[model samples]
Target: MSNNVPTGAEFKEQLRAGAPKMGLFLNSHSPTVAEQLAHSGYDWLLVDTQHGPMDHEKLSNMLCAIASGGAKSMVRVAGYHDRGGIQQALDLGADGVLVPYINTAEEARQAVSCTRYPTAGTRSVYFPQRSMNKAGLLGYAGNANKNVIVALQVETAACIENMAEIAAVPGVDMLFLGQNDLCMSMGLYEKYEFPHMYTSPELQAATETLISEARKNNVILGLFLFGTTRVAEFLAKGFSFISVGNDLHHVLTQSAAYVQDLEKIAATEGKLWTRRPTALF
Candidate 1:
């Protein structure tokens, strides 16, 4: 048994206490953006490492930035990577992890395995990861199981096909949808905001099925949204864990708005502020 200071992870406790939480994605290379979002009172932050340019080195600094903001951190890791990445993410003091491209229950099991110590999973035992406070390991192993949130993605036809079993995985805490990816897989890529998406009887049935399966198995249903546009719709559909917009998206959105506002002001004052992008939005 090791005696040292323990890491305090707050997200899992909020989850267990039946609180619904919201957060934003952090993909900017700038650590200050992460710190700013953290201080914005977001319940959590996802350091996106899957499809974005943010790497481990940058993520490390972002995690440190997040610490000061007092928000929990999660890493959305690429599915192609394996245990090594998962271990590294945990060691970096992330409160949890969300793995992408989970297409089966076995895949869900694999994701959960990497989050725990031996007997519970195959994650290598090492007390020296940054998760420990200055004091040391301090019962990290003993508390990890309860503190970490192991969430798996269910965003493909096959995953939805096996949603029931995946939801039943013993240690799985949440199932999130890669909404954009899932839409693409169904050949409905940009139709998410259109009426056809819901009018299609087949798609509607599948969504209802997924929600039923998650609730039946006692797992939280999560959705990563592109913006606040559909947050209300998703919540009405029963999403307990919600997130909207990445750092980059937020910047692009606000910057475009600022330019538009400036242009309008120039028009009112009879000066030309004509630098609007053709595709701003």
Candidate 2:
């Protein structure tokens, strides 16, 4: 019930306590989608600029939309080398960042340092930026370092090999698993049948080992899925923070279901399904 004012630190606390934290992934650069999902009971929403066509201008708008609806915005920048995009995302008021393709502990260290101030990190300071304008310079600078979350995606064999060091990087809050990338990295792209992503025993062994390493460090572990049904599996595997699904997938699923219902209605009523408003008080 603590809305708008909660810090990413608090979110991490919940995660550390094994509490379930739910969020939706948004690839559409539309502020409308951000606004709607923000108020739709999601604890957090990620605007993925990494793989999406979202620009800074649109990202700012989307952040505003998320703010208006009182949901935390976690922006996924392309990569840690994407310093400009990362800075802009933080400037545009992202509550956190999901950095991708981090394959080494040094890279993870660099990514964490990028989010801090001088002596702590190399993040340049500028007052009255987009993220700072709402709260003024005093509060913004005071909280930026404490409030922003930095989650790294571990999707490579090298990353899994260095998972322990990666997890121990100071200020690196969480480590997320990218299913598609992990599968592809293991040379098993397009092979999702029966849950064994790669036939390579090494990949499976590495993934399991990495998960164990994450647990040992007391760092937050993240898992991504196309839907919530798989959450039980992740949860059982000791994952606390899981991204179950996203807007695009939700839209497709709903659209397909609607089409199927329409066909059923047409057969039963001998006509197309008609739209109607009804109250169910």
Q: Model 1, 106: alpha-carbon shift in Å? A: 0.9
What's the C-alpha lDDT at position 209 in model 2?
A: 77
Displacement of the residue 15 alpha carbon in candidate 2, Å = 1.4
Candidate 1: the clashing residue pairs are 4-138
Report lDDT (CA) for all predictions: 0.77, 0.81
At residue 135, candidate 1 shows an lDDT of 34
After TM-score superposition, what is the CA distance of residue 74 in candidate 1 from its true location, in Å?
A: 0.2
Model 1 residue runs over 4 Å out of place are 1-10, 16-18, 190-200, 278-280
The alpha-carbon lDDT assigned to residue 130 of candidate 1 equals 81
> Whole-model lDDT for model 1 versus the true structure?
0.77
Residues 71-92 of candidate 2 have per-residue lDDT tens digits of 7789888888878888888988
Question: Would you give me the overall lDDT of model 2?
Answer: 0.81
Work out the TM-score per prediction.
Answer: 0.89, 0.89
